[model samples]
Target: MAPKVLIVLTSQATISSVDKPTGWYLPEFAHPYYKLAGKCDITIASPAGGEAPLDQGSVKMFEGDEECQKFLKEESSLWKKTEKLESFKGKASQFDAIFYVGGHGPMFDLANSAISHDIIREFYESSKVVSAVCHGPAALVNAKLSDGSYLIAGQQVTGFSNTEEDQVGMSKAMPFMLETDLKKNSGSDSLFVAAAEPWGSKVVVSGKNGKLITGQNPASAGPVGEALLQALGA
Candidate 1:
């Protein structure tokens, strides 16, 4: 059987109490979707399991892109029929890898979901590939391993940086600074591998012995997916 990948999206549609309409970044999800679609068996899931919200800013940002247009035209069941993460607990060992697609909304949901932490811990502890991009890193930063160390501890990882957050005027809007959280949560034995430039297309592949792949922003989404495929030897 082909390797199976679980793509988890945020169920919340707004950015915490900010009252701003937000959810998964379209390109962050779409770019990787197209890249991995036929290559592996993929399942899209969320905390609630249906109607994942779209961050309008991201939709507008990529509105003219061909892949985004195609994804919007169909709005397939893959996006509409996501399964609840709790349902995957029994099958966690069965998944070959997992991907967390991000947007501003994840700060409010996926990042805080106990279910999210459990799933990441499951995949990471199993040594199966674990990947995330953009704000998606929020989901993995707090995941505690069996040893109680952060999953990103000692791993080369990248996510939305402070500069990027400020550049987008979301520095204060977010409940917590993502980059700082990653480093702060980095174990005493490990720290984050910082990216040189804010918007640079960078994907940090840590865990050569363990599989943890993370990308900095939307620009890094495609590369992240490619890296996951490489990690899987696809």
Candidate 2:
């Protein structure tokens, strides 16, 4: 049987200051979707049950990649039909792994949502792979285990770096900076970063208790997807 992976996308449809439409980055999800969908049974879910917003930048970023472009054209149906977080009811043990696709939206909602935190905790407690990219790692800051300690405590991880945020020109506009928050989380053993630019960085997977895979930015999505598949043995 093919391993089953649950993909969680940010449901926030608008950017903070500008109020521009934004959700999950297309390349962040598309690169992973194409790679994993072929080898595993993949299911999509979101905080809310309706349509997921797509980051306009990603459409241009992965434009030359035919598979990504094809997926983007059909993303409305593909992501809109996602299972609601409430439907999962924090029961994350049923899947082999859970991946969070990121965009500017995650900084606003993913960490603050009780449902998302619970889902992440459940997956971690079950020893399932927990993967995220870019701002997606924001979701981990609040994930608490049954004992009330952060699941990421003492675990090495990565996420969208402050350097990249500045490059994107959204540093001051973001709700909370991810790098600063992660460092303050008290449980993060150590955090890693690519030596190159955030977008050009590769994925980082740490074997801490379970599996924690993280990508630096949109450009790292393909590598992140490939890492997730390897972690699942898919």
Best by lDDT: 1
lDDT of 1 by residue, 45-139 (tens): 98898888877788789988998889877756777889988898757788899999989877778777887898788888788899999999999
TM-score of each: 0.94, 0.92
TM-score of model 2 (CA atoms): 0.92
- Model 1 lDDT at residue 102: 85
Worst 10 residues of 2 by lDDT: 186-195
Off by over 4 Å in 1: 188-190, 208-210
Model 1 global lDDT (CA atoms, 0 to 1): 0.84
lDDT of each: 0.84, 0.80
Badly placed stretches (over 4 Å) of model 2 are 186-190, 207-210
Task: Report per-prediction Cα RMSD to one decimal.
Answer: 1.8, 1.9
Clashing pairs in 2: 153-187, 154-187
